[model samples]
Target: MKVNNSNLDFDSNATDSESERAAVAPVVCLENIHKQFGSLEVLKGIDLKASAGEVISLIGSSGSGKSTLLRCANLLEVPQDGEIIFEGEPIIWSGSGFSRKPSDNDQVRKLRTNLSMVFQQFNLWAHLTILENVIEAPVTVLGRDPLQSAAFGLELLEKVGIGDKSDAYPSQLSGGQQQRAAIARALAMEPRAILFDEPTSALDPELEAEVVRVIKSLADEGRTMIIVTHDMKLAREVANQSIFLHQGLIEEQGDPEELFGNPKSERLQQFLSATASV
Candidate 1:
């Protein structure tokens, strides 16, 4: 397939068009993306485009490959086929066939730094304080001074509303606090975009709101984000657009209000109705 390169350009000159036209150029573009594990295909010819600073939510039932697609966006899982363009550059897929040339380890690391991921598990280091957890990556992997990294880390913690918990270890913090700290860590990398995989799924309802508030603030700041979430309310409120995935394929996608309030596909209508009841 000849991939369309027009949607990948993000130059300032391209921004002079009408607001809607400017918004159409994607900051993140995925075309013919396919992922499989053994014989089970996870993502089948998925195509998605997200504009600069847009929040695109991926929503679906469990096992619908929403999380898998998010992972593939950041190269956490090597898709068997497809092209992913981030920040105007095609993500060099290291896997076999049709994808771009294999990226070396150094190149892969650099690409990952541009795309940070926040997981549901809140994967913080047990021994490190919240501050340390956020600064460790910049200091070690990025090779910045620890003191400089710590300063930025604190700012990120404050941004996520967890600056007060900076000195506390992960074990000492509540689940919500820990997840906020994890988000801060991702922000500390100064990524071009963030990928979230069910960020609030592990939290209780009360705790979930706290993390969602931080995400809302990020969206308000115009940070590009791709969130894989089952929380329909969050999707409806936070997302500028929503994509409905069903059985590893995109069932329907459009403006959040249109997709949620008036779904176009029978599969999406059924999925939403079933989920709304639960």
Candidate 2:
């Protein structure tokens, strides 16, 4: 499978009007995902799929489990009863419910390496310079050469419009710059897809626009990403498919235009109305 080559003559802003990866084999699949916290059920039988280069947006209210589902996809959060299929291969499971985890720890690590995450909080190491933060994972986990990773890190930073800030520490930059640097770090791994947990939630409107521009650029390049976002406009513009989750269950899902234009569920109708006001 020929994905967006991170090393080629990659133009972050270049739009690919060719066919989307909707027909490409799924890079990540969440089957019957169920999660709970003591007595509270966060996700119930949630199913999702992201094909190569396809961007899917997860939308819901504060407690609707969108973030939790995204975390489960990357196994940052464990789902008691669900199957995570990465590149079509299911992770080995050992137990049921709360005790559930991948039987093979090594496999879990390898699977996670491909499903990189960009958090609501930039989560950059405050002590490390932007370039160091970006190259850490590639050099440490992937065993990529530091020199090569540094070069790629600089390219990714430039792609996110923060190349000059590579030597700057997180605290020295604005919130938007930090988030863009975080995005550059996620891109450093050259993963199959990215799981964005509300990439713009932490920023003000002005700062949010900076990150959104980079996200739109990535979408145009056919980079597979599953984004958990509250920005309805962003969902409409960047996501090919939008999923509306209601109290841990998928209430509605389809093309963003169709789902937003003509919502089928009363719950979704109310949610849309509420978010529209925000």
Candidate 3:
């Protein structure tokens, strides 16, 4: 398989026939993206795309910029360089040389409502009931009708397999259950895509599968998703495509089967073999 830097843009219209091929329009496109924290450069010229309904898993060791890249996708972390187009609209860039003014609080809030994010720690409001936590943002932030938001929240909880936990508080639920509720909350907003950052990294093996199952179900239903994870097995099973980052740069990426089963990059091969050895 020949993996080159030429096809790194995330536009769905872009095409390349190297290893494995699939037909779909990319929902998320990143072109020449770069991020830095003072002197520390995290993401270096990242070009990637995800087709509608395609599941792309980001894998790399700690500090490889996987999480930073995911955050930039949803504008959670602003990039110093490059363009990010989500579902078609360019994410407002704040830094110099960008035409659009950086997104303000209100603009960013709206962007977030459309593109939901699920964190690893399951950032739920402990004081609120499961249902309330899910409905809070939609009603308070989006000004959605209370009744309609509640109904939607309930439906989402059920969809994520935790409808019965609506009345319980976060403290009352297990790690897996809490994560599921978080996912439901993200879904309630009806975002064009969901960004997951290490959703299952904190869970034990047994508990992890519950979250994985829900994610798999979402993929089956054709939900566009980008996940930053260390779980190679789950990535292999659920991801249609994969990206491997090394030292803050994309080392290799392609179909998960090709990347995992037969990686071409020396960095990727070394990383996989090391992971397997562990």
Candidate 4:
């Protein structure tokens, strides 16, 4: 398959006939978002959106708020200001500032149902086996059928190249296997949009490539995803839209080819230069 991110048109998979066409909306949208950690402002009046089947990548230096933005998008870190909308519905909130959160906890939970996040550290449950980890959320949070979920979970494990280790505990597997298991867990949710926060950061070169391969396959399948990563080459290969954040704000963003090929912002140029070998 030919992948060209020259214009961030991550819609190659949207090639449906007119008869199959339907009204489409962004899978997720963040509007004028702001976040702070006791006076350390992170995200500052930021707006981001990912449409169905689109792949987006966020890249920058450390503390540029790339991870923070991903956290805020999924409500892992509640933004003090701004709107988080999932599939066009704004998350219900009332209080202001640090106190801001979903007015109804249930609403927030429901919203999370449509968004899946893959963390930097493979946050797998040490107590559970690989298959169990994948099905736990669907069976518990979503109340899906455990028996059916198990069968499907096995399929996902196989897809990620760890099917044979379905019964193995995370602590028993290699770091690469564990991260792939985490990805299987996220896929089990079958979320509309998947948020990846440095999915391969914790792995060695070989292990990291394994996870990156899995991620690239997902992108080819038209899964909508927003990824925060330092892997510039992988970002360019897999993402259509690319964003560069600097000092709590977006410094530059556009098609990955344009942004990575000919960076316009001085900060982005410096950051890219710094990580060129990687």
How many collisions per candidate?
A: 0, 0, 5, 0
Report, for every candidate in turn, its global Cα lDDT versus the true structure: 0.82, 0.87, 0.82, 0.87
**Model 1 clashing residue pairs (backbone):** none
- The CA lDDT at 181 in model 3 is 97
Best by TM-score: 4
Question: Per-candidate TM vs. native?
Answer: 0.88, 0.91, 0.87, 0.93
Q: What residue pairs clash in candidate 3, if any at all?
A: 8-47, 10-48, 10-49, 12-26, 26-51
Give the 10-residue window scoring lowest on summed lDDT in candidate 3.
1-10
Q: How close to the true structure is residue 86 of candidate 2, measured as C-alpha lDDT?
A: 90
RMSD of each: 5.0, 6.0, 4.7, 2.7
Collision count of model 4: 0
Model 2 stretches astray by more than 4 angstroms? 1-24
Which lDDT tens digits does candidate 1 get at residues 180-256?
A: 99999999898878889999999999999999999888888877788999899988778877889998998887678
Candidate 1 least-lDDT 10 residues = 1-10
Sorted by TM-score, highest first, which candidate order results?
4, 2, 1, 3
Off-target runs (Cα >4 Å) in candidate 4 are 1-22
Predicted structure 4: lDDT:
0.87
Model 2 lDDT, full chain set: 0.87
Which pairs clash inside model 2?
A: none
lDDT of model 4 at residue 52?
A: 72
Q: Which 10 consecutive residues of model 2 have the lowest summed lDDT?
A: 5-14
